[model samples]
Target chain A: MSEPLLSVRNLTMRFGGLTAVDDVSFDADQGAITAVIGPNGAGKTTLFNCLTGFYRPSSGALHLQAAGHVHRLERMQGHRIARRARVARTFQNIRLFPGMTALENLLIAQHNDLMRASGFTFLGIFGWPGYRRAEAAAVEKARYWLARMGMEERGDDLAGQLPYGAQRRLEIARAMCTEPVLLCLDEPAAGLNPRESAELNQILLLIRREHGCGILLIEHDMSVVMGISDRVVVLEYGRKIAEGTPAEVSRDPNVIRAYLGEEESAA
Target chain B: MTVPAMLRDAGLAALVALALALPVVGIRTVDTGAVLGLDYRFGWVAIAVGIVFGGRLTALLLYDRLPRGPRRIRTKGLAGRSRTLVRYAAVAFIVFAAALPQLPFSDRYVVDTATQVLIYVMLGWGLNVVVGLAGLLDLGYVAFYAVGAYSYALLAKNFGLSFWECLPLAGAFAAFFGILLGFPVLRLRGDYLAIVTLGFGEMIRILLINWTTLTGGPNGLTSIPRPDFFGLAFTRSPAAGETAFHEFFGLAFSTQHRITFLYYLILILALVTGWAVERMRRLPVGRAWEALREDEIACQSLGINRTTTKLTAFAIGASFGGFAGSFFATRQGFISPESFTFIESATILAIVVLGGMGSQVGVVLAATVLVLLPEVFRDLAHYRMMVFGLAMVLIMVWRPTGFVTQRTPTVRLSDFTPDPGAAR
Candidate 1:
């Protein structure tokens, strides 16, 4: 009943004649998982892009309220949406800095905070005590996240060489290092096996419970969606055809028809 | 393997040998007393063909006989060992370079050549920041170098500024130019970025050539003040109210004193640049650069300001180029636009890339090889470039990633662990 953390109003994104995300509207509450599920080309990823400021929507308003401040996502730049709005994201394809160690990847996620603490490298260069303290704190924070992701022992290993499942977890850990009010994950479980998916589900649940940050997930895997998501929004042909609890959305005839085309259902 | 496969490989080898030998053996010109005659060095060609054929057959046989798994494991082990070896080699090289001028056999030519090598080393380190750490291909890095040289030349000549006074000013000017170039080409990537930067370098050069009133056109500025030892000039006689450096030290005035002094100056400057770059690599901004290099979109999504990150890399990198440029101007006592040609940029860039993009030790090693090799092969004359080109090709073929490809992670949660696989 309380106001949601993020509110989207009539978000529409069109490319030439094709409408990718057609007037989509949704609300994601704090400390809850909202899963957007649809078949291929259903614009779930497109919606995430618009919300994250990667794409300027043709017409839309995204209002994010955090710490008694409101950010107009549509007006902010991509980096501002992440830094000022405290929104973090992970790509569908893992985007870890391949040459960097696992620890450095997490540290980079805290770049802005560290840059400020170091007086943009001037104070740090002179070994200012305050800057040193901040740097140590950053290392500690990075260590805690690495331990949480169960990659503490692999902190020195190059990120690209980590096993696929571990890389996925490191990506999440990196995003969490930014201490975002909202975390957006696109297909975090795409290539993950069932066990990895189960681990991912538990990690997301723990993040929500402990960190109290809202999660926006776009997942093609139904098990991950149905298992942990508090609410599900299903899209078909870029339109929000169904939205409800997992069981309700599963039973909805429209959702069923969208998954299994009408021709197959009729046959 | 099968007999037919062996026969086919033998046939291919024969064909390759024939093709290789035809040019050297079939087309030959010989001189006779009266006119010209055609002659062939078939013996030499036959020997070359035999070596190639034998080497290929032996390699094929060995490859077939050896197990692949153990070879891979051995290479991985070697990769780990080589990293430590490289570290030791770098330390030894530094020690050698520091002691070169002090050595009994070090003469003026040796000291002078070593100083030139240090300049390229500094330039290589500067370009490494943009091309290697930041992953911005900068084909026009010489523009910043030129800016630094001209800034120092103009300042010292017109305003009568000391070399020491003009050093930082030149760096600032170069950094300004870096940001100027960075702003317009911020959106370009890869080859497009390369072309734009290449054009930017040419623009600076062409402007320097045409702007006659300020730059003295192609004639350039001359008699720029050489760096003094504080207020003391390294000359035979003392100026008004000041003693010459050698007299102040109670040592006889030898021209070698100034040459040696200049050598040490460049060495110190180069070491400072290297130290600063190494320190910055550990700082937040440097890590941001590496991250941006890996994935620009990911960097933006993680709240990193891409524009600022890139501009900072350019500015800082250019400033070092500026410092080196000013030193070059003071060293030569002159400046000309010809020194800031595209080939200068290419050579510095080659040093960075050939040394292994982000490795400081690699840059030093590469600069030494590039600068010293030609001087060492001075007798080879026209053949030196051919030899240099061949060596580069061999290096690229043998170790495509570079001589020192392993990257030490900036931040580590635990004690450093050498990951052999991280070399890539």
Candidate 2:
């Protein structure tokens, strides 16, 4: 079988004395959705942060294999992780450029590509033909994402003015604009209603099947975790207790106890 | 909330004002012909207390009448209409400025004051790139101006270069200094960044004062060559090989001709600066700067390099400040550290802020008001500042954000074709 898209070995992150993510390990494959499930403060975000280069891990090896290249994700910076590693993420809370338009938010995700085409903006300032063509292509891509998110008409509206669900979708569309090999989503359905969550599941499935990018998701909504995710990695107190197909992990006795605690363990 | 509550509030305020005035404005030392005597001006105190009480009561009543909640939508519509009105006003102002020197009432004093206003407008636009679009609060903006002026002075004196030759060089030097400051302050944000920039501005001034050999110390460098009309000197008598401007044009030599030329030069420079800044707003770098301003973490996730993006803003903004500074040196034919001070920085910042942070047209309007307010109130002597302060307070109370706070998007949906075929 082809190697998994991403492999994490012994990943641990600590804040002074508190180990947020402790010896967590998982394999997420290309064209598959892997959901990391945990109770609050089970280090789900900490793991995502480590993967996206927001925090330097205490000890870990993160290797992303894409397009015949092996990228050591642990060695890169926050922006380099997105740029060179082709890894993009949406925050737990939406972090769109509120003052900019939805179209601009997508365009910014394509910064590296546009920056090169603009000759680092020297050619762009003078509106060189090549830069103009590149910019038009970029705007086209932004429009495409807007249309896919059912927001094509609202392209010019400021991102902050968008409705709550639209903002969440816009954030995902912005991440997709980077064309990342792996998309990390932190609680995309946190504020979403059931209908929106269902829609979000379809979008995730479409991204996985069409784009063929590995998806690393951290979610608490069991419907989303069980209905769509092909693989499940259960983390308990910053430690991975089970990793398998969704059906296999859901039935695991250890997983159940970790999620619902042992009968008398607390008492 | 009620009439009685407001009356009580006003009464309490009046009592406090009386207590404060009793030790200050209520008493004065009078020269009683033979000896100085304390004059208890009880009537003045009563008048002051009465004014405060009436003023507070009136203000409270007006505040109660202000529209709230649902009426805010009308205010938004008003903002939209005002934006259009501002655009028209901007065009009219530009036309009036262009014809100022040619107007019947024009003279050296008028042209010079107008020139000073243009200089501040240019500087405000430059700093707007950093503070307005990029969200970097720069307080040391005057440092670049000083650098530009000093760079022009040193270059013209030492290398015998003309003003045109030194203009770009001065801008480049200021840009270099901007980067120098940028490197250390990249990690800072908001108020911390502002404090550092303030310190940086003062540092430049202090450095100029002590760097005697280069900047001629506090006395400053005098007799700096004025910019010529190309190679033609603005003089009655032509140098051996050089042509006098009047002679080249076959017109009479008048000092007024030079003054008009200087005015037009600055006007052209300022217009170009405005044009370039507008163009930049539509470009990728400009969008990146605005994006960085809105959310640094989001910018990082989008793969925009924070370092280069911020440095570019600093460099571009500083270059414009430098250009204005070079023009200033040529206009005055003098260079001094005193010309670039914290107050100058504050005034330029005030123009940007009062105009509206990201509004280009707002800067021009604000610059005119800020620069001309002092001149218009010159006869008021010490009271001029009080008048200025009152005007500022009134403006703030009226529109806390700015005179024009509406932001026009750099690009619109109509600007591009949204091709369905582009979707993967």
Candidate 3:
């Protein structure tokens, strides 16, 4: 009944007159898992980019109202978007600082906090009680999150050396360290096994329930999407074809056509 | 890991303190040896001090303290820029002589070489700023050096100003030229940046060779004034009424006084350089360089302005080179484009790279090896260039990251969970 947490109104991104995301709109409500699903080149990633401020949309608007504030996601750039509006995201490809340790990767996500300390100087690089406390708290928070993900033992391990699956897990943990309000994930299940996917499902559920944050996921896994997503938006060729609960959208003719090619002209 | 490392560090520190102090009590004079038809004096103290100095320093290449918890840095100030201020003050006190010199014996000409070594130490530290901290590989850092030397030569020769007056002017001029050089290479990356800088150095050298009116062409600017004490010019004595710079205490001045003054001047410069660089590394721009070195895209995402960051690196680095350049001119009392050759640039860069990119101690060692080693092998000075180049290649092959790489100081570990979405 309350207003949606995130509202994308007629968002369009054009590259040389080719509308990559054309007149697409959707809302992700508070504490709900919203799935954006489509085939390859369906503009799912493009839409995600627009939301995260990586790509400035050519026209229309993308707004996030969360944490007692509203943000024009399309207008903000990368770092400000993460810090100011509490927007966090994972890339389609892992983007961890490879040379840094597992703990450092997470700590960097709390860069704003560590920087705030400035030795002890609150406003500068002088000794101050405030910075020390902030730094300690940031470290504590980083440790707590790493431990929660079962990565506490491997905190000193190099981030790049972690196996593929743990690297994926570490990426998620790093993003969480930012304490984001709206978490956007692109193709989280792309290379995951059933077991990993199941673990991922539980993680998403925990985020929604415990963290009280809305999640926008672009996924191709049908079972996971249908089982977990409270609402689904289907896009094909940069245009939205259906918006409904997973069951409703699964049965929609347009959605079916986008996936299976018109059912071979069911004459 | 904790107990063993602490014990090892304690032992090493104790050993280092004793070894460094032994020379103070034992060696009061230099030893002389005549070999291969040349006058030679090799002090065991010099080589012993060199080893202990190198030993105490190379330890960093082996162990870096990564922050694990809240105790790595002691901060009693506010939580922002105040931390930066206090850090700078601490570093300054340790590096500079609060706001400020040394000894010389041996062959008369050896002092010039020693003085030159001191000058290169300052220059090495300066280049370390750009190549080490900023992760900007410069093959032509000598271009700034050239700018400074020529700035002094042109200004002092034409205007007849004292060497001290030309010092600040040379630095400002070189800094201006640094911005000029930095502008075009802003978009360049890696080898391209190296190539552009290499070309820039060549350009400066060729200009010095051909710019007859200002730089004196092949003849070079002659009679550049040596660094002098006010009203004193390294004289052995002065009249009772007139105070000689070295005779302030009424003692008969010796050649040792001039060498000591020059040694002390370069030492002060080197200390100032090391301190300034360490201070800058802890500032906002300092952190910006580290971030940009690690990931440029992430740096931009963090709202760091890239252009200013790059320019600051260039300007600061060039300023130091200029200070050294003016000092070089004053020390040698001659200015020629040949002195600022491509080899000079290569040698300087070699010092920075061999020292371990951003490590101050590393740069000093590299400079000592590169500058003093050949002098030690004056018998093979003819083949010194060949040996130097070969050593550089071998070292790079041994440690591709350089002798000591810049490490972000992290000191402790903690438990933290990452965003599960981060996997995507």
Candidate 4:
């Protein structure tokens, strides 16, 4: 009933003669999980890239209303989309700073806020009281995320050394440190074991409930999609084929056809 | 060990020995005043070949006989012990450096060599900020050094500014040049970035040569004022209305005093640079640089402005280079484009790389080795470079990451209380 936090209208991305994301539109509300599901090359990633300002849409309007401000994400640069529009993302492949410790990775995610507190390193260099306080606060925030991700003990260890599951959680924790109004996760559950996937679902649920940030997830795993997503948007051939509740989308003929193929659909 | 394997190794060593001996031993000519004659040192070659054969056989036998698991465990233990030993060695080195001038046998030559070492140490540390911490692969670092030197030279010559006055101004000018160079190469990465920076360095050098009026051209500026001890010149005799440093201190007016004074000045500057870089490592900007080094896309996703982050790294790194350059000009009492060359950049880079990128102590150790090794082998003349190259190759083979591979993280979550209440 309340206004959706992010409204995407007629978003399209073209590469040469091919359309990667074609006229796809969706509304993701705050305090909810929105899953975008598609097979390989179904343009799910392109759509995510468009939303996060990694790619400029051929034609679209992305309106993100956060903290009583509406941001035109299409007009913003990639970094501006993250900093100004309050959009944070985790890559399909975990892109943690491998050499940096898990804690440093999280702290760096809070760079803009800390940079502001440090007066762009001028205050920080001198170890001003204000910068010290902010730094302490940042460490505290990083510690909290590390603890929540069950990585408190491994906080001092390099991110690359962490187990795959922990790295995935750390990536999400890093994005969370930016305090994004909208969190976009690309295949966070990919390569995760069943137990890790269940844990991820719980974490996402907890984030939606407590943090109250809207989550946009792209997942190939149907169990993850059906288990937690409040709404499902099925994309096929770079176009939205179905949009409804998980159960409704699962029952949709187009969605079934997309997943099972024409021969299996006929059977 | 298999007999066949041992024989194969010996055969390989024999081949190597033959190749080595063929040029110098087999094909040798001698002149005995009146006549030129071909001579054979086959006996010497045979002895060398025999030694190589024996060495390879012994190595293979020893390697085969060693217990693998215990050897690995012993090495692991040794690694841990060596890390602590290295720390203690570093402290010992610093103490020795600090007490060198006060030592009984430290002459002007020793002091001057030490000063040169310190300058390279400072340059290595500065370039480390860009290449090591920021992972920018800057191949034109000497350009900043030139900028600083020229700035000080021109400022002191035309404006009559003191060394102290021109020092910071030179640093600032170099930082400006750093930004100027950084702007065009922001989008470049790795090898491409290296080529552009190399071109930029040469461009600056060429400009210095051609721009005869400003930089004194190829001749360079001369008689640049030396940095004084708060208006106390380290001169043979006091200038009008001023006492010489040695005279003011009631010490003998020896040239060693000035050399010692220069050494201490550089030591202080180098220490300050080290201190600043260490502090900046824990700062947000520094962390951002490291972050960008690790992953650029991730950095952008986290809202770090890549351009600003990179520019700051360049500016800060170049500023230190500038400081070292001005000190160099002051020390030499002259400036020339020749001093700032691709070789200097390569040498500085070698120090940083050999030291281990992002390791401060590593830079000091590397700078010492790189600067002093050549001087120590000055008698070897033509052979020194070959030895130097061999040493570098050996080091790379032994530890490609650097002499110091481990890096201390800038921030640790364990340092803070993991309080959920505080987190809120």
lDDT of 1 by residue, B115-154 (tens): 9999999999999899999999999999999999999989
Model 3: docking quality category: incorrect
C-alpha lDDT of all candidate models, in order? 0.89, 0.90, 0.74, 0.90
lDDT of 3 by residue, B299-386 (tens): 5443345677788788889999999988877767787887988888888887887877777767766786788777776787455755
Q: What TM-score describes the B chain of model 2?
A: 0.89
Better of 1 and 2 by TM-score: 2
Native interface contacts retained, candidate 1: 0.79
Q: How many backbone clashes can be found in candidate 4? A: 0
Rank by lDDT, descending?
4, 2, 1, 3
TM-score of each model, paired residue for residue? 0.90, 0.94, 0.72, 0.93
User: Candidate order by DockQ, highest to lowest?
Assistant: 4, 2, 1, 3
Distance from true location, Cα of A21 in model 3, Å: 2.3
Clash-forming residue pairs, model 1 = none
Q: Tell me the docking grade of candidate 4.
A: high
| lDDT, candidate 4, at A4 | 92
Candidate maximizing DockQ: 4
Q: Write the per-residue lDDT of candidate 2 for residues A1-267, one digit (tens) a residue.
A: 489999999998999999889998889999899999988889999998888888889898999999999999898988899999999999998999998888888888888898889888778878889988888888888887787788889887889989999999999999999999999999999999999999999999988988899999999998999999989999988999899988999899999898787878657
- What digit string (tens of lDDT, one per residue) describes model 1 on residues A1-267? 488999988989999999999988989999999999999999998998998889999998999999888899999998998899999999999999988889999899999999998899898877788877777777777777877888789887889989999999999999999999999999999999999999999999999999999999999889999999999999888989999999999999999889886755456
RMSD of 1: 4.8
Q: How many clashes (backbone atoms < 3 Å, residues ≥3 apart in a chain or on different chains) does model 1 have?
A: 0
In model 2, where do residues sit more than 4 Å from their true spots?
A265-267, B2-4, B11-49, B62-93
- Displacement of residue B263 (Cα, Å) in model 2 is 1.5
